[model samples]
Target: MDLETVMQELEALGKERMKKMYISNGAHEPLFGVATGAMKPFSKIIKKNQPLADELYATGNYDAMYFAGVIADPMAMTEEDFERWMDGAYFYMLSDYVVAVTLAETDIAQAVADKWIASGEELKMSAGWSCYCWLLGSRKDSEFSASKLSNMLDQVANTIHHSPERTKSAMNNFIYTVGISYLPLHEKAFETAKAVGPVEMKREKKKSSILLASENIQKELDRGRLGFKRKYVRC
Candidate 1:
């Protein structure tokens, strides 16, 4: 469908509760607050439409931007295009979930993510780390370099506590992802998580979240999910 029709459908699916939640999570006006699941049927209908996705993302509506990620053709996008998208991502949900998730599907995923990780911008760093988490959780362990991953785990152990709140959360998740999904560095990731200990992620109004990657990794291990890799990164 077209952008207008899609926006209308998304607006029709909007809910007050979800809108409030999005606002609380840093979304601004012009959003319809449609649930991500609610957009699935239309996503199937629209499939991957780079042009339409660009139009929707440019709208600056939270739900529309999210839907843009759902319909975006990652393989067709350039690093410049992804950089443009990253420029529009204003919050953790958009950066880490939408932009990073879409980037994880591309061949340039690691290259671009590396640049973003080194960007030193809060959301960019968060998205870069989160992109790694998505990649490790879905792609085969053989696709990654064990030494690089080991160094990343060391980086998390050394710097996560002092990183930005969102970056810390993503870094903690990176440790857990390496522990559970990337078998080559599981032991190293475990050691890193233990050394990192609990990470405090401060929120605007909510209580700070205590993120313990070691504990989360142990929980997954308890469930016999060690070395687990998902078939897909996005739903």
Candidate 2:
């Protein structure tokens, strides 16, 4: 559970073996490093070794270490350290898990979300979803400033709009995370999706998100009228 052991294990799981059989031959730059997606399924085991995870995060591979941070409080990150960590920083692998943990039925989850949401970096915007999702699940009458939520949605929608089909799928998945878990933000999600337009030349699934956002909008509005919840849905 200490830092040394976790480093040893991650070192053993080098980039190649971690690739399994997937390869990218045609691109100008083929896959080179370990991806966050590859490390996610091991969350439970990762939690058991918290100190090690923090140590790894302090290294150049801080991205993956972000998973452990959200999952088990990424080591002993000082406030000053996290501020630097937020600069050009990302923990892409555990996007969904971060969303889930922030929204989870827990005691200190709001505190955890507050820490992550402190990072206003473009790359770290999904922490907005983590906070938004947490509010939806835990606070029935949650009211929040619409500006930041809309900012996150706008940035993410644009990113998904231009990404490759596969990447678009990942972005859309996160968009839906915003939808399903953040009722107060449902209209923003729906409007964002409506603005996304049909997928252009590169990635066709861009518009696929509208299907989801539209669903969430209707579902929440209908249930909301029945007193399931109430909040301002920004136009």
Pull out the clashing pairs in model 2: 3-52, 69-74
lDDT of 2 by residue, 91-135 (tens): 333332433332333444445445554444323444434444545
Error of 1 at 90 (Å): 0.2
Residue-by-residue lDDT tens digits, candidate 1, 1-235: 8888998999999999999999999999989889999999989998999999999999999999999999999999999999999999999999999999999999999999999999999999999999999999999888998888888888888888899999999999999999999987888889888888888999998999999999999999999999788887889
In candidate 1, position 169 carries an lDDT of 91
Query: Candidate 2: lDDT over CA atoms?
Result: 0.46
Q: What TM-score should be assigned to candidate 2? A: 0.46
lDDT of each: 0.93, 0.46
